[model samples]
Target: MARLETAYGPLPTDPGEQSRLFYKIYSAYSDRVGVLDAHGSYLAARDIGIINLILFILLPGFAWWATADVYRAAMYACALFSAYVLTAAAAQVYGVRLVENVLAAASADHD
Candidate 1:
């Protein structure tokens, strides 16, 4: 597989180093543009819709159908919400990495 190129050379194999390098490049590119802001807004809107669906529809239905207890449903919702937030955060980081790679690739090609 082809390795990703950046200003610092090939992407690091170590997870910690990779994250640092990606953020470094991403910051440089984002400082010149509003890509991060746009992406964040998009994610925020999507999260709002997902949260609404979970709290308003799914939680109520789950409570009525399975638990028949407000407390149990609330606990379940909290766990589910926590998991969703973690997944969303991971997705956001992955998205930023993708954008960073694209920008870095383009910059490498341009130069």
Candidate 2:
């Protein structure tokens, strides 16, 4: 398929094509770094487990210990969890943009 032209450069229009391109980039980097079988699922599972541990148990426990009020602790936990979620989302976006910019530069060089 022909790539879609943009100010940045040519970009894949098909979702599957873009995914494959990204996979190739990641695979090359992983192979060079000797990270065999580096998969998103593993990273995601680890992140989720850590987040859950902190969000569901540690945060509330610590908050309660500090505040000694169940309602206040609950509110504090909720606020902290919301901030964590937003920060994670922003980081994800930044990572995606970094990858996109790298791909664009690589493609531009090839052209």
Candidate 3:
């Protein structure tokens, strides 16, 4: 698959004959990311309530600076990023399960 960069983000353009399959995967990934971003707002709210938003950013922000030569800030930021990924993954799993269950029930009724 070939990659194409647009206003939204990177997308697979050269799907060859499997464009549909490629798009299905991409759509799922996009949905997961969207869910993560939506849920991350709750986390942001909590951080804001505690006034730890800056602290969170600054702790590593400073540690990153203090360490020098390397990007400690990015590493610390990665901790939050990993959390977002896990959150997204869990939501996606739940979504898939919900869809499967619904489909199974519908099929059982028809049969």
Best candidate (score: TM-score): 2
Q: Per-residue CA lDDT of candidate 3, range 1-111, in tens?
A: 112222224543565734564444445543454444544554554444344434555576676678773566777767755655655555565655544443333334343
TM-score of 2: 0.52
Query: Considering only N, C-alpha and C atoms within 3 Å, which residue pairs clash in candidate 2?
Result: none
Q: Candidate 1 or 3, higher lDDT?
A: 1
Go through the candidates in order and give each one's C-alpha lDDT.
0.63, 0.58, 0.49
Q: Regarding TM-score, does 2 or 3 come out ahead?
A: 2
TM-score of each: 0.46, 0.52, 0.36
The count of backbone overlaps in candidate 3 is 0
The CA lDDT at 64 in model 3 is 69
TM-score for predicted model 3 compared with the true structure:
0.36
Could you give candidate 2's per-residue lDDT for residues 1-111 as a string of tens digits?
123243334566799987887776555455332223223434554476457546765778888998899999988878767766665665565556556554554454444
All candidates in order of lDDT, best leading: 1, 2, 3
Which residue runs of candidate 1 sit more than 4 Å off their true CA positions? 1-6, 32-34, 49-58, 61-110
Candidate 3 has its poorest 10 consecutive residues by lDDT at 1-10
For each candidate in turn, give its C-alpha RMSD to the true structure in angstroms. 6.8, 6.6, 12.5
